[model samples]
Target: MTDSAAEARPPSIDSSRPHPARRYNYWLGGKDHFAADRESGDQIAAVMPSIRTAALANRAFLGRAARHIALQGVRQFLDIGTGIPAPGNTHEIVQAVDPRARIVYVDNDPLVLTHARALMSGTPGTITYLDADLRDPAAILDHKDLHALLDLTEPVGLLLVAVLHFVRDDEDPDGVVATLLDRLPAGSWVAASHATWEHTPAEVVAELQKSNRDGRFVPRDGDRFRALFDSRVQIAEPGVVSVADWHNDDPGRAPAADVMCNALVGRKR
Candidate 1:
């Protein structure tokens, strides 16, 4: 294969175990997933039929939220838990509005890092990828790469899309969000989407829980999810609604009722 072709190919990911990033890629109709990821996705979809719809909805919300923040004149971004390279990624969506946009993407998964490095080849804006976990907000905030691209005094867009659910309560997910936001300037924004069980059925919830036996996903209620933003940050308009209903540019593609994810954008006070 040509160099470009090889770059276009998905990384050699492990197929023995299901990974959240790969499974999420599969749901978003990307080619970067393995059989194990597909099987896990299929099992989740079998119980919660709207899993794919939810993924699409969450992706759409990311685009809208990024564009909104970009228009608000935030030229720097720190996107945590960035999954595999897919259509409408954070840099693509934001840089389309402002070519000068600088973005820092953080993800602990190696396969995601490989694909992300490949995607950075022809990217127009200043984009850097970091192999880091969200559980360690201090490392992310103090990283040399992050500081090189983003100025702490300037307004930045802190994106935590569909990743915080992986952070268990024991790790203090809410505190983590607060800590990251605290490191940013007052005008900076925090945009996030988290999975919830509010709209799911009891049996389906149980099955979903069983599917995530390793405790990677921790679905929260609407209030608990909102609490992640805390009182320091002021919630933006259309506060913490379903991902399908969060500032959707394409309302026709609204996800199904069972999508079960809440989204919100907040500005630091």
Candidate 2:
């Protein structure tokens, strides 16, 4: 965990509470989760049986989007709300296309910072991790390490995968996204996937809403999800579809109705 001199002490991990990243890891069948995380995951799974499938599909979308952006000649990436190091990480996918690609992963989780070495290892490209929260976009953009590694004047691939739902409407999620995107140069790409209940059954949606009364998760509709990009970018083809169907050519892929997540990739104008 490389920390800037100005960085404060990393936040302590609260095993008692459920974190989005850990719960996500549990859904992805990873072992770096706590009992509270499993309990939250099981509760959600009980209502949405296809949640695990949605999680997998969202991860696949991240890979596809990263590779797609990299192939387009963007060599710098800023992946915010980065969960625990998983397979097909943004660095792994993009650096494969260009060894010199630079990546900065930002996450508030102290546990994710502990796994920073794993995320940086085995890749020739420049990779660094920052202990920051999505709610404070300025902290991420102002981090010395971020400026040290990435040339923000050049085109970048901004990744906000499966993490926006953790932010409630009152927190100004749209503003948070805008702040990050506004800092990037023109021609930069942004790929984001957010949880949604648009395609879900009413009964299941009601149950999900009740289960999420604690306000840990917020599922938006398609319109709300699409509005995250604002007028600064142009959404790519097959816009605002399920993560499973985003640029995926699998013959037997799950239907968009089955996956309760919306994904999109856009280029800055």
Flag clash pairs in model 2. Answer: none
Q: lDDT per residue, candidate 2, 132-241, as tens digits?
A: 99999999999999998999999999999998999999999989988998999999999999988888889998888876877878988879988889588899998988
TM-score of each: 0.92, 0.93
lDDT against the true structure, each candidate: 0.86, 0.87
Residue-pair clashes per candidate: 0, 0
Superposition-based RMSD of candidate 2 using all C-alpha atoms, in angstroms: 4.7
lDDT of 1 by residue, 1-269 (tens): 12234445445545568888988988998887767788899999998877888998888889999999999999999999899888899988998998899999999877888878888777744999989999999999889988888899999999999999999999998789888988899999989999898877788788888898878789888899888886878999888899888876564765536678999898999
